[model samples]
Target: MILYDEIKTLSDKYEERLKSQIEKRVSEMDGDDLSHHILYQVLGVTSEEGHDIDVYQNKGRFLYKYAGSFLEEAAKLCIKSKFPDSATTRVDNTLGVRPKKFEIDMLVPDGNAIEIKWRDATTDGDHITKEHTRLRVIHAAGYKPVRVMFYYPNRTQAQKIQKVLQDLYNALDGYYYYGDSAWDFIREYTSVDLYKILEKIAEVKTGGK
Candidate 1:
């Protein structure tokens, strides 16, 4: 069995490395921070009043789907670094027909089954409701549901997005987001380079104590 301290130590070290990488990528953006900015806009709050709902919906769909790809990349990093041997990462899967069609943002194999989610930045009450719906589907399908919320740097005008996420999670039924205080875990788990985390986990396992 993996000791708690060992897991914590490895998680911390990996998170530090992840923070540097994410910062670099954010800093390198030339135009607007397209991913986050687009996400907010697509959700329909960033523009002037009476923005066309149809246009917003189209843009939102495009942005959300694009972001799903990014989430998969991040998930792959997480699985590779922390649970390399025990995990297999996938973008989305369809198990059956009609109501059973679920698009997972990322799927990581935990001990007994797969953990899935729809990645989002803020889990504000409204957003959390939607997340909960997805979680319900996953639970019904005999898989573990994990909600992964991305923590971004606080904007000067917006008093940190993390608080909004917390409020959203608090309002949810029975489930909560796990990475706010444990952001160190996010840093350790995500990677810009796919498979890097898995390779690291393998190295650690190979050199085990």
Candidate 2:
């Protein structure tokens, strides 16, 4: 329950951050308050024939796509700040591929695989299954101290996944986090505020945009 409370606070803070970003963008649109307009545009973009159109108008989709990677970077940074060792937090590292292949989000110094997902619909059961396989294979290879942790935001679509993943993680001796619970996991590992890290990343990214 404490984890749920932490997650709620973190989710509220994250929503505020998003609202702030939208307000800033609207202000930049010649003070037109086009946040709603932008939202409409974001929801309007669509993929055709399994290919998405790459255009400036699709900035919303682009942001949504990059959010997961950005969160991974934030988590990696938090871990490195606490560890201060390059080898402690490796991002997007390919471990091994013999009987099965494994590419992970973050490889902790303790040999834990941390897979971060951000409410993307594409990251469904199949994705979880693959990651589970990778973890099992890695564990079988005498990888001591091996663990897999999944972090994802809580959304309407994620309710079922949260249940499914809880069972999967339990069976694997791993952990699954959703909503504010994920913030608890990050805090447990690094004692850093993920929301703050994400805010800084957003600032830097907006400058480039």
Candidate 3:
């Protein structure tokens, strides 16, 4: 079974860290920081009015960074609980000069090269090239690249990027699982239902609602 207590502890720690960061950022929102939002200024948004937007934008960044990290680690716990021999490894990027190595989130004894992600909303075209190189290297190393992304992006551009990635993976003999399918894949492959564990923890957080 997966460690629910450890997952809960991780969630709590992330929450506290996020809270502390937000408090620190908001406290330090001085005149210089508040006055530099060019688009907000062009929209006739006063510094006082822009404060809310700045706060939320900063909060969004923190949330995005932490959310991805928390879910990836949680998924690792679930997978490693089932396959204790699995581990992360860095492979040489034979095709790239910039990124000399690509980090595989998990490498199982059976040759599954796992790439865990909570969400991917990248609209950058260069990201596709980097991922292609990464996958080619993985295939060259005899590991089947498998992407497990728990959440699907909401925006249209992001969805298009993901579609392209999915096609790239299939073309290269890699696997891509996202949204509900990703969760199901982990459950079936690892024999651990990650969604149920997170849902129960969330219920406790939301007062059992």
Candidate 4:
């Protein structure tokens, strides 16, 4: 229960900060020049000479990609913020032999897999396709206690996704993580307050100088 409360509080804080940051950025952008699809392209847009794409610069490099990297960075930052020396726990820096192409978003010291997703619950087809394949691979390879974490901006969206997963997947017996249920599963395995870490990471990235 404590973990769930902490998770809810952190989710609330991060979402509030993210919403404000997005509003601020939108206000600064030239709305008249923005197109409908352009507004929707949070992941990334291809680099073409005459594509009329919006280019942003940071640290002398073109900051073209968003969404996935942004979410991943935030997740990594949260882990670092909590573990400090979590660099070694991450599988990204290490490589090993595998039968097929696979990547773990975050790996705990106990060998648990964490997959993070933030998208439209109604349209995102990952649960049936990529996620199923990834879990099957991990299980076949003898990986224990894998987790799929879905990050929504609010409780309503999170619940909707939870229902969708429940309705669609018979294979997902106890692998999906969202909101309080996720917090419970995470706390059962580790004492780390993942939700609080997420909240802190969001605050630092969106509001920090």
Candidate 5:
């Protein structure tokens, strides 16, 4: 329960940071960033519409960043509550030359190496190559590679990449969990129902309860 309170405080802090940053950006946009409207006008988008678009996009960037970070930190807290000695670790990429090392999000002493992601929405095909090498490195390091992704990709190409990654994980005898499954995996393994607590917090914050 104390950990849940910590997550709630973290959510508030992130929300405040988001609001302050957005306000600063919007104010700066009033005089300095308006030149982008010329290009938008050439593309037939009005200045008013362009300004709205920029604001929306800017807000989206911050929201996504904060959301991802909050979930990861919260998940870490939940996991640490169960695995007191678990920690984030770096393992050398023995199978590759370019990537020096791979960062494992959570490494329990029992050899479960977790890679946490809020989402993987990249359409880049090379993401697979990088991930393959990383998993291979983790596997070679005598650790079981596990992926716990809170959200799945929405676009078709991104989904396809995720599918391939899932297959790769399976091939390497690793574990993969996405969306609801990722949350459940944490709950089952850590004995902490983070998803439920998060839902309750959201309801209370948004006055939707």
Candidate 6:
């Protein structure tokens, strides 16, 4: 299968694992919070489906949907890791005054953020440019942001995909995606273990701290 399909498949599996963990955590809690319910629903784990409809057209909507899924998993992991049994953990709470207009792939508390982008031939350059723009804005606003480019099928002939990513990082002032470092950040921020972070997050909610 193609890389996108592969990633999607893995994401699905990851979601299942995440769901289990979340359910277990909630079982231990005294009362349910709206933020927790919102997160659970957003990640597609909850049975309830509110206002099921499409907002964006074509692939744009699909991209946002997947990106949001990834971000929710990351946020859940981060909250569990940092707070564990703490009842005051606010995973979905916005830290800054900025409105939640953009779809951030993954985000961490204390201003650490990640924006994930997937590129095919049709919109690779556009995606890269947009990421750069967003990075600049975040940097200028004094927030630590990380850009993650997950290229599927690996068909770009101009240069290696890693090189392309490197060049993009080099062009940016404070953005970087060094080998394994990006994954490391993903792991740390998401609180999900490395081996099945993506896949498990897409599958069941495994027990986590």
lDDT of 4 at 185: 49
Tell me the deviation in Å of residue 155 in model 4. 11
The deviation in Å at residue 31 for candidate 4 is 7.9
TM-score of each: 0.35, 0.53, 0.90, 0.43, 0.93, 0.40
Ranking by lDDT: 5, 3, 2, 4, 6, 1
Off by over 4 Å in 5: 38-44
- Model 6, position 32, has a per-residue lDDT of 38
Candidate 3 vs candidate 4, lDDT winner: 3
Q: Candidate 1 at residue 33, lDDT?
A: 32
lDDT of 5 at 23: 92
- Report the alpha-carbon TM-score of model 5 versus the true structure: 0.93
Q: Write one digit per residue (lDDT tens) for candidate 1, span 1-209.
A: 23323443555565565555545544453333344455557777564322344345444555555445444444544555565564543323343333345555445454223332334344355544454555555565556654444434345423334454345444433233443422334454543232344346556757643
Tell me, by TM-score, which candidate is best: 5
Better candidate number, 4 or 5, judged by lDDT: 5
**Each candidate structure's count of clashing pairs:** 7, 1, 0, 0, 0, 28
List model 6 lDDT by residue over 1-209, tens digit each.
23334454556665565555545544544343445456657778562432122112223444555555564454344444554442221122133334334454444556545555443333356555554555555655555665554433345552354456556555554455433654565466545444354554345445442
Note the Cα lDDT for every prediction shown: 0.45, 0.53, 0.89, 0.48, 0.90, 0.48
Ranking by TM-score: 5, 3, 2, 4, 6, 1
Write out the backbone clash pairs for model 5.
none
lDDT of 4: 0.48
> What's model 4's TM-score?
0.43
lDDT at 17 for candidate 6?
55
Number of the candidate with higher lDDT, 2 or 3 = 3
Model 5 worst lDDT window (10 residues): 28-37
